[model samples]
Target: MQTVRVELGERSYDIVIDTGILSGIGERIKGFNFSKVAVISNPTVFNIYGDVVINSIKNAGFETLNVIIPDGEEYKNFNQTYQILTELLKNKLDRKSCLIALGGGVIGDITGFVASIYMRGIDFIQVPTTLLSQVDSSVGGKTGVNHELGKNMIGTFYQPRLVWIDIDTLKTLPKREILCGIAEIIKYGVIWDEELFEFLMHHRESILNLDPLPLTHIIRRSCEIKAEVVSKDEREAGLRAILNYGHTIGHAIETETGYSRFLHGEAIAIGMNREAWLSEIMGFLNRKDALKIKAVIDSYGLPSELPEDLNADKLISHMKLDKKVEAGEMKFILPEKIGKVKIQKGIDIENVRKALN
Candidate 1:
């Protein structure tokens, strides 16, 4: 197992990445003292690995409760969050209760948010089942549900007590979902590590084929990069914004189409292409590098363009409502090169429109 510690003073925790770690989760968590345990997950995930987690906690001798939410980005809302909180309250779960988020980004976001607000704060573990969560959402401590107004419009910086990533869970993920996970994997390389980017390019075929060796390396490196960034800027006050490389436009695409239209990573894939093109026009990224990014996205069967029905005006309206906007000025993370980026502010709407097309 590869372990990375997120140093956050009293809130610090370790992220464990390995194959088949799920089976040993109970033994791993036995050291923590808690009055009760809540396992928050979606139905699809529950059907697959819920038993393993529940059984482990049972063996650990803690009173446990399972809260299963319906799966999908559309279900990530205040209603669902409230539902989970109500369940926790009904069970008389105190501050000593621990939550285990056992699904993808949506589950992690909602559960972590609930943990943050329920009784002020509670300990939680992230058992990210998808590649997207394991590498990105599960590590960062940024948690929230989508408001009707925007993606992640309501959230908090609530760090997890621990993040256990079992690569074994991903083997059961749908192929399309696995590709969605790759979008974020690509983001890590584009914004931080050139060597990692080259590694991805060289093993693109192997990654797509779900070869465990390369997949494991890809996920671990991505988590390492994210952990390093979060350590430096846990609240996203500075350098952390670079991690949003594709998110500005990506969030707009998701909101305009409704969350159901694109998977979070799919929207990010489109966002990366659009932002790369924007960078090229701004004289930062060259056309060849931009195309290289696009080719990698296309090679994995991810979308590289906005849907036909999407227009500049609708997208612009959504962008204006983005959570990253400050003083009504828009900020974007644009590529400077294959492994470099800058968070540019006051981006002209005209240029954004041109890049989206």
Candidate 2:
């Protein structure tokens, strides 16, 4: 077992990673003095590893209940959040009770949001089952549901008490889901770690085949990079904005497509590619390096270009409403080179148009 710590003083927590770690979670988290615990998951996930997690928690002597929400990005909204909140209330859960986010990014996001707002605030644990959640969403403590107008437009900076990652859960994911995760993993390499990028480029087959050694290495490295960044800029005040490198255009794609079209990582993958082109056009990144970024994305079987049908005008319109915008000027996190990026503000609309086209 390996652990990565997110240092936020009192809010600091450890992310525990390993295969078959799920069975030990209750024992690991039992030290907390919570009065009650609620496990939040979707039907699809609950059907898989639900019993193991619940049994582990129960064996640890904590009173717990399972709250299953509907699956899918479209269900992550006020309606589902309200449902979870209502369940917590119905069960008489107090402030000391905890919430366990027990599925992928959507489950983790909603559970954390519910914990943040439930009776003002409550503790929450992230047991992210999917690769995307395990490496990125589950570690960052950025939680919330999507709004129709924009993705992640409504959310909180609430951190989880612990991030419990069981790589074993990844075996159950579909091929598309695995690709979604690789997209985020690639983002970490592009924006922060050159060695990681090279590792990914060299070991594409091993990683894609889900070979345990390389898979665990990338997940650990991605979490480590994310943990370091989040610790420095917990509220995305500065350095943390770099984490949104692909998200500006990505979120716009998600919002414009109504969140039903591309998964978060898929949209972000496209965003990263387009933004790389924009970076080259603006003279920050050379065409060679920009194409190199695309190559890594392509090698992983993730989308590197926007769908031809997605309107450039509408994508821009949605981007205008993104949370990253400052003073009506759209801010973009553009790659200066692999392993580094910069926050470019007030970019010319024509430049964005050229990249989109």
Candidate 3:
């Protein structure tokens, strides 16, 4: 297993990535001093790996309660979290018990949110089952649900006990889902690693086909980059904001479309381009570099632009409510080049509209 450590002092944890690692999670959890485990997942994921994960926990001497929610971004709200908390209480899960998030980003977010608030806080392991979750959401301690006005507006900075990623799960994902994950992988390249950008460009065909070697490399490097960032800024105090390179507009896109029209990373794919264009408008990113970024997103078979039906004004309104907003000015994380980004504050609302146009 490949382990990436998120060093947050006592709150530090390991992100373990490997094929067939799910079956060993129980043994891993036992070491965390948690006796009971609450397995929170959606129906689809439960149907797929429920037996294996549950049995593994049971074999490792853990009393387990499985809470299955409906699968979708729309379901990631207080209602679902309330249900999970109710199940935890009904199951008599205490601080000594841990919650294991066993699905994609939604499951991990809601489960971690529930774990954070339950009896002050409880241990939770992120068992991300999708490409998008494995590469991005699972490694970060940011956990929350979307408010009607914003994405991840109702969340907390709660780290997990462990992040267990099994790359084998990618095989079951649909092509659209694969593309959604690629959007994030592309974002990492744009924000932090120029080498990763070129590496992705060179292996585009292999990555598109989910060839194991390229996929594993993407997962490992992406997690390492995120883990390093989180270690420095555990609470988004300063350096961590760069991780939101395309997220301000991306969150707005997810909210404006009601989280139905696009996947999380798909919305971010559009957001990345729009924000990069914003960089160009601000005289930060040159047009040639901006177009280079957009072209790469296009090559991934993802949407590199916002949907026409989305109203620019509505997106702006949603963005004003984003967590990144400070003093009535939304802070935009824009790319200046393939491997570097800048957080531009005091952004004019009109400029955002222009980017949408």
Candidate 4:
């Protein structure tokens, strides 16, 4: 097992990555002092791995409660959040109680948000089942449910007490979901590590085939890169926004489609392509580099182009509403090379339109 630490001083936590670690999670987390435990997951995941986790905790001599929510990004909302809070209330969970997020990103987000707000902040652990969650959403403290107005609009930055990643859990993941996770893995390579990019290109087949070694390395390195970034800029005041390289336009696409048309990583895949084109037009990245990025994304079976029905004007409008925007101007993180990036402000709308075209 390899451990990476997100150093937030009082909020610091370790992210443990290994295979078959789920069987020992109860003893692993027993070191933390808490009165009670509640695990939040979706039915799909509960049927698969929930029993083992709950039993493990129970064996460790802790009272445990399970709260299962509906699956999917669309269901990450107030109604579900309310349901979780109601469960916590009925169980009389207090600030000392810890919430365990035991599924993919949606479960982690909702569970973390509940822990953050319930009784003015309790503790929580993250057991990310999907690759997207393992590499991106699960590690970061950013937790929230979708609002009627937007994705993750109602949220908070509540760090987890610990994060447990078992790569074996991904073997049960569907191919499309694996592709969705690959998008975020690709994002880490595009924004920070050239070696990681080369490693991905070389191991594409192994990763796609779900070979254990390659997948483990991919998850570990992705978490390392993400941990390095989050350690420096926990609140996203400056450096962390670079992690949002493909997210600006991606979030817009998600909002426009009402969060049903594409997976988070898929939308970000398209967003990276659009941003790469804009980077070329603005003289930051070369055309050849842009094509290479698109090719890598395409090789993973991810979409490299926007849908024909999506409107450029509407996308731009949605971008304006993104939380990253400041003082009426949209901010974008654009690549200068495979391992480097720059955030540009007041990007020309005409250039954005041309990229969308």
For every candidate in turn, the CA RMSD to the true structure comes to 1.5, 1.3, 1.8, 1.1
Model 4: runs farther than 4 Å from truth?
A: none
Native-to-model Cα distance after best TM-score fit, residue 110 in candidate 2, in Å: 0.9
Candidate 4 RMSD to the real structure: 1.1
Candidate number achieving the greatest TM-score relative to the actual structure: 4
lDDT of 4 by residue, 141-183 (tens): 9999988776689999999999999989998999899998898
- What are the per-residue Cα lDDT tens digits for candidate 2 across 241-357? 998889989988988887788888899999999999999999999898899999999888888998889999999998897777889999999999999999999999999999999
How well is each residue in 17-122 modelled by candidate 3, as lDDT tens digits? 8887889988887776786888999889999999999999999988888999998888999999898888888888887889999999999999999999999999
Clashing pairs in 4: none
Q: Which stretches of candidate 2 lie over 4 Å from their true place?
A: none
At residue 312, what lDDT does model 1 achieve? 78
Candidate 1, after superposition: displacement of residue 251 in Å?
A: 1.7
Sort by lDDT, best first. 2, 4, 1, 3
Better of 2 and 4 by TM-score: 4
Output the number of the lDDT-best candidate.
2
Clashes of 2: 0
C-alpha local distance difference test of each model: 0.90, 0.91, 0.88, 0.91
Q: Residue 258 in model 2: shift from native, Å?
A: 2.6
What's the lDDT of the predicted structure labeled candidate 3? Answer: 0.88
Query: TM-score ranking from best to worst?
Result: 4, 2, 1, 3
The better-scoring model by lDDT among 1 and 4 is 4
